[model samples]
Target: MTTVVKHATIYTGTEKIEDGYLRFDQQIQAVGPMADYHPLVSDDQVFDLAGQTIVPGFIDVHSHGGYGFDAMDGNADEIDQMVQKMTANEGVTSYFATTMTQSHENIAHAMVGIKKAATKNPVIQGIHLEGPFVSPLFKGAQPEKYIEGPDLKAFEHWNELAGGMIKLVTYAPENANCAAFERYCLAHGIVLSVGHSNATRAQMKQSLATHVTHLYNAQRELKHREPGVTGHALLEDNIYTEIIADSFHVYADMIKLAYQLKGADKMELVTDSMRAKGMPEGVSELGGQKVIVQDQQARLENGHLAGSVLQFPNAFRNIIKFTGCSIADAVKMASGNQAREFNLTQKGTLEVGKDADLNVLDSELNLVQTFSFGRSFNPENN
Candidate 1:
């Protein structure tokens, strides 16, 4: 059966069209002006969205966990709970189960759990390993005990454990043997994102030249002399960049600057949220390390910044408020741009021949409804 949603204010991640209609049968079949659609001739279930905005369901390329469940917990049930929470509450139709820096064994175990979760739920895309290969100098909330230098053997082991389901990996470009690892990741269809490093501008250029395609710019700061990886990320046009957009991780002006420099097409917004997200502020565990949340920032006992408490929808709202970007552009950052960057051909945008994943938001920007693979899910269930 076909589902036809009409009379919607459609934000197709690029343009806004009032009184638009979209038709889908497991996948998008057509999209155009609502007046052109005839529900009488078509054997379809018609839903009138009134004037609510319909956009592509969020695609979170980088996230740790949410709703009191951490991805690194290595529990399939916990991971499933986390997925349900994100999908129901935030309208995240697809997401990467990002793992924090942990032991080789722990990372492998977490990957296995993620693989199991993804097998059961199509919305849980794959695993994003944020480290074991990062620099200790920039290891914000990651435990130093788990941080390790780049090793091909470890990478191979992780790959095998994940059943080749690893989609993205973050590491320090300046780490030993990183060039070879970055090349290997590219060869295996894995996205290598530079992050948590103090690499100089020259090192960053060299790293990007070698095959690294993405960079994480949430935690790192910009300095005049150092220029840092964040500077290099802004300067590089070909590479995609991820920003947290939580206002605390980056200033409003810097978010605007990144969008201008990288263009909205090349930028992806990530939550990087921790377990404490959507919960009351208090102590929490991230990758086996104790973290304290106060003043809207989460930091380890040792004072290293841990993951964030920001959810995906909140991040989207902040990006729009801070950057003055159009809602279409902001939605693209959350879904379309992310899908394009990760080469996820099926899961982003509301065009024909794409996945039937979408989110409906009211004029207030709150998620009103969500559909994943043509099935509607309720946020109140979370």
Candidate 2:
């Protein structure tokens, strides 16, 4: 059976088409002007969007957990609950099961859980290892006891436990023996992202040369003399940067400046949400460490940011409001750019032959409906 979504303003994430229509089976079959597409339909389920905006479903390259469940728990039932919560409420059709920095044994255990969850849930893209090899000076909320120097044996052990589903890894480029680790990751088709570091400008640049294509612009700040990680992220043209875009993680002015400098093609928005995301403020556990959530910010006892309680939808809205970017541009940052960075060819755009993963939003940027693999799930039912 085919579904015809008509009378919508389509932001393909690459282009905008007014009064457009899209036809799909399990994948997008056609996208074009409504008039040109009218004759292509026959006995199809038609949904008149009534001018609502239709865009590719948001893809989060980095996110930990949400809806009172932590991805690091390594529980299949708990991970499924997290996926349903994110997909039903926030329109995240696909995401990485991110793990926090933990002890070697704990990280291995978490990878086992992520592997099981990915096998059960098709939307679980892959695993993203976010620590264990990072600087103690900029560990943020990561437990100090779990922080370790760069060790290939540990990586190999984790990879074996994960059954080789680890798709992305995050590490401070300044860590000891990082150059060898970077080469290993690149050789194995794993994406290496720099994050949670205090590397200077020259150090950051040198690290980027070592096959680090992505940067996590979460904790570091910009400085004139030091430049820091954030400066290299903003000034570099070839690197893809992930911004929290929650207005609290990064200032509005800096968000706007990043958009201006990198454009929507190279900037991706991620939530980095914690277990308390989409829930009330209170105490929570991030990778077995205590976290206090107050006023939507998750922090450790030492005043370091633990993670976030913001969802991808809120991040999208904040990006638009803060940067004055078009809805299309904001959507591109959340979907298209992420797909490009991760080399996911068939999951990002609304073009023909792509997956039928899409989000339908009202005029005010509120999610009205979503489709994952042609199965429509309404958040109102939740």
Candidate 3:
């Protein structure tokens, strides 16, 4: 059966169309002005948006977990529940399951479970191996004991254990063994993101990698004399940077500055949310460390920023609030930019022939409806 969604202002990520209509079933068949309207069949379902905003389903390139479930917990049931409870309700149809700094054995164990859980789960696309190969100097919420430099053999073994589901790997370029590991990642079709490091400006320049993880939080500052990772991230136009935008991770001024410098094209808004998300304030766990969620932030017991309780919808709204950017530009940062980053060519943007993964928002930017795998579900009711 085909569905025609009409009477909405649609932001195709890069462009906007007023009074548009979208025809899709699993994949978008056509999308344009209502003037192009023609029913595929008499039985085709039609949805009247009544002047709402329609955008692609938000894609989170980096996330830990949500709804009281931690991705690193290695629980298949939790993954299943998260898929239905978190993403379906929050309009995040796709995401990466991010891991944290832990022992080699523990990290491998999480990968093993994530691999099995991702077999057919629509929400989890790939694994983001965030640590055990990072610098201790900048290991924010990661356990210090488990921190180490680039270990190619261990990484390869973990990748194998993960059933080759690892897509993004974050590491410090200051390590001695990084070149070989980077080579492995590139050759294996993995995205190597620089993060959790105290790398100098010269070292940052040498990295020339494509992605920077959690900009400014686990990273150093942009000093006049020393420069550093943050400086290069601000200056370089090629590398895409991740922004928490939760307002707690990075200051509001910094967020505005970054947006001013990078704009939506180079900025990818991520949640970096943890198990405490979608849960009431209290104690939680992340990478075996106890976390406290209060005042809308998640932090380790020792006062380090653990992760976050932010969901993608709130991140989408917060980005607009922080940057004062257009909903179209914020949509790009939240969805299209990440889609282009990971080659999810069919997954982002509300365009003809793309996947019919999209969300509908009311006038206030509240998620009202979601279409994932071509089925419409009320986000609030879900």
Candidate 4:
């Protein structure tokens, strides 16, 4: 049966429809002003939203794990549970199971487990390989001992183990033999993202990478004279930068500054959250290093900023607050940008014939409910 949602403000990623209606079942069938809406049958599932707001489902391309489970644990059942929590609590209908820099064996194991979980859970869209080829100079929470230079052969092995599920990779451009690595990734439909690097401006300018991971954190900082990785990301219009807008990872003013530079089209809002998220503040571990979670921040023993505990819904709300951008623009940052960058054709915008992945929000932009592949769930009760 078709589902109809009416009397809502809809952000279709490409446009906004005030007092509109949406029709869908696994895929969106129609979207338009309320005057244009016509129910297909008497028994269709119709939801009178009472003037709520609807936007495309949020897509997180750089999340590790959450709800007390780490993706690196290599447990398919636990990963499934973690993804369920992600959908229920954060309105993330699609996610990338980001992996950490670890031993080859451990990384391989994680790839296998993520592949297994993804087989049963379509929400596990792809894998973001974030390690083993990054620079030690900016290894924030990544384990340094396992950091290696770019190696295409090793990456090919891991991707094979993942059944070709790896879609994005975070690496330092300054690493040796990076050109070949970047070439291989580009040829095979993988996006190369610069992160955890200390690359100088000249080095970064030579790179073909089109994405930036957790911008301004664990990477070369912007210097008036040097204009390193951070500056490069801001200057290049083709590069999509991921920002953790949790206020702790990036100050609100700085987020606004980035928004001014990159605009909504080139910036993506990612949680980058870890296992400690959704758990009470206490001692935890990330990438085999002891971590302390307090004050809404997660940090390593040496006081380095670990992955965030920020929820996706909070990040969605924070981006609008920090940038003062319109909800339509924020929707682009939260979902539209990632879909365009990663080529997730079925997952992003709310329009005719697209996947029925979307979220219902109150006036204040709080996620009230999520509909993933035509299945609805209330976030509050989850």
Candidate 1 stretches with Cα past 4 Å from truth are: 40-44, 209-221
Q: Residue 84 of model 1: what lDDT?
A: 79
lDDT of 3 at 240: 90
The most accurate candidate by TM-score is 4
Candidate 2 per-residue lDDT, tens place, 281-325, comes to 888888777889998899887777777888887888998998899
C-alpha TM-score for every candidate: 0.93, 0.94, 0.96, 0.98
Report lDDT (CA) for all predictions.
0.80, 0.81, 0.85, 0.91
Give the Å shift of residue 130 in candidate 3.
Answer: 0.5
1-382 in candidate 4: lDDT tens per residue? 6789999999999999889998888888889999998767643789999769999999999988888999999999999999988887888998999999999999999999999999878999999999889999999999989999987888999999999999999999998889889989999899999999999989988999999999999999999899999999999999999999999999999999999999999999999999899999999989888989999999998999999999998998999898899998999998999899888999889978788999999988888889998888787554
Ten residues in sequence with the least summed lDDT for candidate 1: 210-219
Q: Candidate 4: list runs displaced more than 4 Å.
A: 380-382
Q: Estimate the lDDT of model 4.
A: 0.91
What ranking emerges by lDDT with the best candidate at the front?
4, 3, 2, 1
**How good is model 2 by TM-score?**
0.94
